[model samples]
Target: MTKDSVAAVLERLSRLYPKNIDLSLDRMFELLKKLGNPQDDLPPVIHIAGTNGKGSTLAFIRAFLEKSGKSAHVYTSPHLVKFNERIVIGGKQISDKQLLDCLLQVEDANDGAPLTFFEATTAAAFLAFSAYPADFVLLETGMGGRLDATNVVKKTVLTLIASLSMDHEDFLGHTLAQIAAEKAAIFKKGAVALSQKQLPEAQKVLETYANDRGVTLKSEGKDWKIFISKEGFYFNDTLFPHPALKGVHQYANAALAIAAVKELNSKWLANVTDSQIAAGLIDVVWPGRMQPLKDFPLPEGWELWADGGHNPGAAKALADFLPEWNDKPLHIVCGMLTTKDSENFLKQLAPFADSIHTVPVLNALHPGRSPADLAKIAESSGFRNIKIEDNISHALADLTAGRYAPGRILICGSLYLLGDFFSSNKGVKNDRQ
Candidate 1:
């Protein structure tokens, strides 16, 4: 592959727009018009938006649909390892050649237009989905839902909203209601909207938005519920196996996905069985979320884990799961972007972690907080023992120097940091597949 490769094309596309995120659909609409409005030709779209658990919920939905013998075209953002991981067609990651061709075609149609990288690449994804065949298109918003590039789809089969929180307040809004409205904007008329458990303020806003759009809203606690029993978990009356993914929040994520699948079966997957749902629950694979790192350069009896949780909501989830590792003292290796709420994020996890090691996310598109600065934040967040490391390598070496007892080491904070780790460290398997 030469300069026309997908990576090269993506790099060139990044410079097409001056601002990284304009958060407007005008440029995306214009680009789609040039490409014959490929978004209109896609299969039944399942548009998802929220603060946290969007990716995990989508993963569960994909697993359920695929196990039921259905193929879907998936689009998600912030690729951990490669850009190709963001787009999957018919149960397969988009090939480099195919992606390159679509990107080049989009570039040609774009004709050097000033669209954000997300908008341009999303245009390419829609183009590829239009040219391919699939039962559904699982579209995830890159940022806020109202003006997000992926929200160009006029109609959708089901609109799913995961747990909403305050993460991107700068672009979305300052209050929870404001952010909720931005995400609830994805709801289309006649499209039944389903949401996971939400804060009271967010739930009220979502209800108002759903009513204004004449869309039926099915909420987790109100419309349906997941009950945990001595044996296993159940989504309403249907029994489900425990989710393969770690963390207790996965039960709620799985329930939301199972509900979405049930809603889809009436029109699309008519023959999906409860057995299939159980299989999907255990077969799902979502990387960089409480992922266990094995065969890495850690000493014996020492464990390494990685997650992309950068917000307070995600930190709460991590803190909830930390108690499970009570046998091992937890040492945190964290790196975050300058845009995130590092203080609140650290505050949520500081109570659970024994020590905090701050590092910088290498080669991130956005600027990362310096290790020294992050250490200061950790100190302010109630972490007494804080260390500033040059990078993950240095942190790992120091942690394994036999100074402290052998325990678990978690590399978390930003998805970009996890991506850097995956790219730089060799032979460290996280079982993403």
Candidate 2:
């Protein structure tokens, strides 16, 4: 159980930097130098970079490897409930004592130098992983890959790129090709790279980057592909178990993870069999991405679901899956960060939802779009019935009391918003979690 130690460290770290994202590797490299470069001492690492699906793909890789009897140290960013969720040591969340001690050590090593929150926490994770025994390290880039703090590692055995789209346009370039180029920077000269299926424009940019870097990239739809059926998923004619993730898009993400495991030339996985990969298909758990809420305080007649997909591509993916909910009324309680394209995101979901209730996300990192602002955005996107609520409890109360049949409810937008849901409704399983 985590205590005030975790909270106190996070508060101090956040105060070290004014802004959240300052994308560069110099600070991370300097800190690692002072700490004797723990990143170089870790086991073989699988670096993952993309706009979306990176986290789920990393989860699949961990599940696949762990099922094959390999221990892994996994790192991801933008925690849902607690900061501890970002760092997984030896297949478990770092203990409260372990996390706080590592953070304090890194903080002291910094000696009043400037480091972003992500950079500092990631250093702590690397240090912990280096000291511990693990066969692999699964690292996910926090944002755009080229200058992400996590990219400072000295050795990355394999790199995987998931689906890319226009996100973080302010930091990364505005165009899809530019964003693809930035993600491709995660590819090192001696490391192997595997990419998910990309749009033609994005694919062209990645191809150029690969050729320029003199690295060969094995991409989906070429080097490998998957055939999805109701029974299970087939990769290269060998069938694996069904993907436990909620969205149909998960089939594609699972295929990429499977491809990486199959393609990696590592002694650690030299004896891994197909049956382990099949078992791993049903083992991975990534919350807030099309996760269903089981025991939240809802009326007996209603069903609730939550997803933390915040970008236009994520919105498109959510729109594609929401249709399968079938026949029943689907109402959405949505909140979004001010940095997101709210109108375009709601434009995709507007056609499916019976009504949309806008709420402000309670996080201050990025002040969320006000409910009034979000309501107008929803209204412009062909949403006929739009309501603004101050908080999620009132939204749920009004929704339950309103004139509607037995139906499903979707709470979406930022992961911070979903974090609020998790905090308010504790002890509820976010399905497969």
Model 2, poorest ten-residue lDDT window?
Answer: 263-272
The 0-to-1 C-alpha lDDT of every candidate, in the order given, reads 0.88, 0.86
Candidate 1 contains a number of clashing pairs equal to: 0
Find the candidate with the highest lDDT and give its number.
1
Model 1 lDDT per residue over 1-433, tens place:
4567777888999888755556667888888888899999999999999999999999998988888889989998788888888889998888988899999989999898787888888988998899999999999998889998898896598999998888889899999999999999999997899999998999999999998879999999988898987677988787778888889888888888888988988756546678988998888889999998876867788999989989989998998988889998899999999999999999988888889999998777789999999999999999998999988989989998999999999999999999999888767764442
lDDT of 2 by residue, 213-271 (tens): 98889899998888877888788798887888888789889999988787653524445
Candidate 1 matches the true fold with a TM-score of 0.97
- For every model shown, the clashing-pair count is 0, 0
- Runs off by more than 4 Å, candidate 1: 1-3, 19-22, 430-433
**Could you estimate the TM-score for every candidate?**
0.97, 0.96
